[model samples]
Target chain A: MNRRDGDTCSSTPDDSLAREERRLGWTLVAPALGVVLLVAIAPLAWTVWESFHHHDLRMPWLGRSFVGLANYRELLGTPRFWASLAHTAFFAVASVSLELILGLVLALAMQRASRGRALIRATVLVPWALPTVVAALLWRFLFQSDAGVVNAVLIAAGVLDQPVVWLAGTVTAWVPVILADVWKTTPFVALLLLAGLQGIDPTLHESAAIDGAGRWRVLTRITLPLLRPAILVALVFRTLDAIRVFDLIYVLTGGGPGTATEPVALYTFSALMQNLRFGYGAALSVTIFAVAFLLAVIYVRLLGADDGRGGSTT
Target chain B: MDSLAAACRASFLLLVLGACGGGRADPRPVVTISGSAVGDEGAILRRQMDRFMELHPAVRVELRQTPDDASQRHQLYVQWLVARAEDPDVLQLDVVWTPEFAAAGWLSPLDRFAPEAAAFFPATIEANRWDGSLYAMPWFVDVGLLYRRTDLVPEAPVSLEMLPALARAAMAGAGAPGGPPPPAAGWVWQGARYEGLVTVYLEILTAHGGRIMDDSGRVVVDDPPGVDALTFMRDAIRRGVSPREVLTWHEEETRFAFQNGDAVFMRNWPYAAALLADSVRSQVAGRVGVSTIPAARGSGGRPASALGGAQLAINAHSDVPDLAWLLVSFLTAPEQMLERAEAVGQLPPRPALYDDARLAAALPLGVRVAREAVASAVPRPVTPLWSELSERLQIALHSALAGQVEPGPALHTAAADMNALLERSGLRYGMNAP
Candidate 1:
């Protein structure tokens, strides 16, 4: 803000005109700033404040009192909290990586398609159009042990003699969760990448082909380098979403077979809503916000550096 | 534009004033009771509320609908009570929640009303008392029962060891020539990781002479008996007596499996008996039998049933405590309970009603079976930390049953966590104080 003001002052010799412009800018942006403060900053501030207190709705006799960082201390000490954080990181990395890979393949395929391009793109978005909870429930039904279609097909194909209880095992439970997430969100990532793919100059690919470059060589050298920004965008979006996942896993496995698939957001919800431990829940919320913010900042930095390099290369 | 904005603001103020004026026009004392109001439950509650309004013409009784799901309803009630809303004067509490609510000071003590506590079953009344005072009135009782196919088993198992054996034999005998198709599994219960799972574990634990907490409120769920109980449950699945799929089954799923003649033995609540007796929907309609869950052989444990039911209590923040008590007393009255039993198959809390011939005709399982089950009913530990404690136990039980961890280690972890929770909340002292 200071540099922008300095530039305005230096560019314009008239001091009063610059002052008037600054005032007008403030006036024009006041409402939006007020809304951000009200909706975002205020709740975030309140949650941070709450995290330092001791408040349990179920135990009213304990009374609401400021306890410094006692809630945070307890949260950090909790094995479940650490496990949930690990689960969230694992889920975010696994699901987001799968989505990115599958999405890139879909985007490339869509770009190569000549006939019925619009129809193909629209039809590919069918899974993305379905609600997350609905999609998760569909996957759950398909994976059910006794009568699910997954088991039926597997048995028919001589894959197994008996149906496997997917949700009953710790490792097996994550299959449906990650698959549901990827199924529901890969189209979104593909759409983003497809936009980036379209923006790449056709001349670049044409020149590379005239030079006897193979399709794979052209993709690696030109298409992929240009798709960096879009991939980063998809990664940031999917990672943030996967980190805060609740309803999909909630509907499918309920974070169970013993909280084996529980994410930090689900644990925070259990603390806040189910157990009514507002103070500790607020601490969990603040921690998740910090992690997401840190990741976003890192991604934005990478995007900025990539933009600068792309400008020079072009 | 200024004039239009002024006009809208003026009309909004008038609307608010009009609403307040309308509320003031009703001079009668309004009492709202919130509980399940879905389908038949809704119809029965409406009828009862209408009768209540008729008896007390000067007051208005309103039926506010709450979520039918217990956990959702519990969260809603906590939010409401924490905010101290006065409209919902009466609350229908689960038996396990009475202590939690009372300890939180969200429920008004009912001792002042001089309720005939002796008239109800001792265990039912005991569950509602907190700190030597009655806080709620037992409305109806729900006890877990061992449901077996009478045609397959011929008689109830005398011991827990014999139950799975009988189930295995029944499964082998089910597909005889010209008989019913082969049963899929031996036994089924609510093994899902939730409150239902805890109740199921409690029945098994008690049957093996284990208690979650001793009388003095010390955590004893990791004792030898508890280990034996969990091992028995785990081994049943391992031996194929109970299906591995039960790990995902809740009450309804188990009921569906048993009602379809897929299982020879099932464990469930009294509510299932009514649905199971419907020949159109149930494959083994006339062949079902109810018995108390049997004790483990040589464990010196008695046949036990996990106690569960609903209780009526006055909201502590209510404006009309006396009127709320009146409604509570009325609903828990013997006649009303019997009516509820006949209409919905909810077992009356009053032991005296078991002798009534009408209950036998009304309840599909008959009064004798219900009486025996209720007689053996053991309440989950009465503590304000019951929800949290039960959650931990559910995880442990589910982990062991799912083969994620051994029963001993899982239960030990649960006990340690629960004890720490109790200590941190300072409820241990409150619970153990003489």
Candidate 2:
């Protein structure tokens, strides 16, 4: 437009064309970038800002003031935070590991079945299809101390002389929660692993049999090694999902019987929504985001290392 | 050059068209109100709102049914009011929420209306006042009452010690001679870790002459009566007077157990009276009887109960405060209050309404018993920090009942926590000055 100063466009046609392409690319992505900023990045940035202040809605008389790092310092000193962190870690580790093993077993079973293989695969997905809240409620009813069918059957079979209060104890409370989670998500992991199971070539199995390889040898040497990528993917996904568990615990128990099964997410929700302490809740949220971010980085690095080995199948 | 000119003209036309298409305003003003009302209560509210709409044709009133839990309702209001949304013009607040909501400036002051404060119960009016100004209007009154199987126990037990024996006698009489006894629990109340649990603890504590805080805003629960009340609750489970499953029972669960004839006695709010008497839903319809909660032996305290009710408040951000006040006034007027009380067994917000022949004749036992309870019902500590305080009390009480801590130490820990939180903030109940 300012042709009097210099004509850069005429001086280099290639540079002008490249600049036009960059402009078109940014124009195409502007809407997506705007949506991301509005929906995700804006709220995240606001939360980070709020974490540095004392912003409690319920106590508005105590006007919001900048108390940098005070909220984080207070939270770190509180015992409940460390306890909830440990609980979240334990829950994620236990549930993800159980889901992985169970999922692998189910995947193998479905893969081996010659008759009604499709039906078996479809049936395995039924638990995963139900909502997590619904599944948690069902498990809660099943584990009820008095009128639960589980207690009735156990008693009728003489498994115990009396009914056990399944959700009343600290260690026992985690059992039903983990069991419900595993039941709901194991199918997802199985479906992922089943794809890997199918990816193994029939020729490889045939060759192993001709060499007189036993079932154990063929399975360990070929099947598992080929399934490693899928297993890693499923593990990372489920682990992250398990770390942010809130719905199941909220419905089944309100982190109760003396805060026995409270995870960090539930703790943050209680502080933020229930107590209306925005500043403290934001601090807790930032900490959780940091942990999740670190985990994601580690997972990506692991996958990158695996990819460098150059034998990953899809 | 021609293409660029054409593009500019097209963009200008589009902007003009967009501007003209917007700002189509409606002639009628819409007034939206949010509250939580169950089953018949919701229907009644809808009917009343329909009448109000008919009277004022230009004002369209929308009634929003919020979450059933009080804490959830608080969260919903916080979400709306914090964002300064203008849709919900009125809010129904729990009695205990008045202090917190008023202190937060989320509720508009009603001093301009000059409401007839003398028309309502003193305690209900007292609950609506914060910083020397009324922030809400009393909608209805609620107080806990004991429901007993009248066929088995002809007389109301005068003391807490008498309830265990009376419930056991009823259970034994109902049992068959040769086989296992009928499957029934003795006494049931809300034992879940929620706001209801705090109310239950307060009633039990006050029955044994324990106070939560004094007039000067001091923590006063670490006393002998507090420990005794807590120990009594734990003993109720240990002695098999109350079942272990009550640990997970809230209002719904306890209501189910009682209505199904699995419990001999239950402690519940006034709303349960009508629900229990509904023959379609209750097995012990005619047998249900209401009485004031029994007292602690030797302490000589009056029959204690917790004040539980809701109030109506105008949203501070509402654009139509006058219309909102009109709705509140119409809903809480004496005529409407008595109509609700006569129809659904809801206690009127005024003490004078208890003497009405219509209410007395409709439900003689409930009205009489609820009146007595309301006369002496104790209010939980009125403070802006009520939610946090209740959380601590709930955990302490739950831990004590679950056998995780001794009653004495639990009271001490709760008192210490309260003192630390209050002192650290350096703010009193009504003194919100920083």
Per-candidate clashes, comma-separated: 0, 0
Model 2 residue B228 CA deviation (Å) reads 1.9
- Give the candidate number with the greatest DockQ: 1
lDDT score at residue A302, model 2, on the 0-100 scale? 87
Candidate 1: tens digits of C-alpha lDDT, residues B179-294: 77879899999898889888888888888888898766778889999999999999999999999999998888899999998999999999999999999999989989999999
Best by lDDT: 1
- The TM-score of the first chain in every model comes to 0.95, 0.91
With candidate 1 superimposed using the best TM-score fit, by how many Å does residue A120's alpha carbon deviate from the native?
3.4
Interface RMSD of each: 6.6, 8.5
Give me the runs in candidate 2 sitting further than 4 Å from their true place: A1-38, A310-314, B1-26, B54-58, B173-183, B430-434
Return the TM-score for candidate 1, rounded to 2 decimals.
0.93
lDDT of 1 at A119: 99
Candidates, DockQ: 0.44, 0.34
Model 2 RMSD vs true structure: 8.7
lDDT of 1 at B12: 51
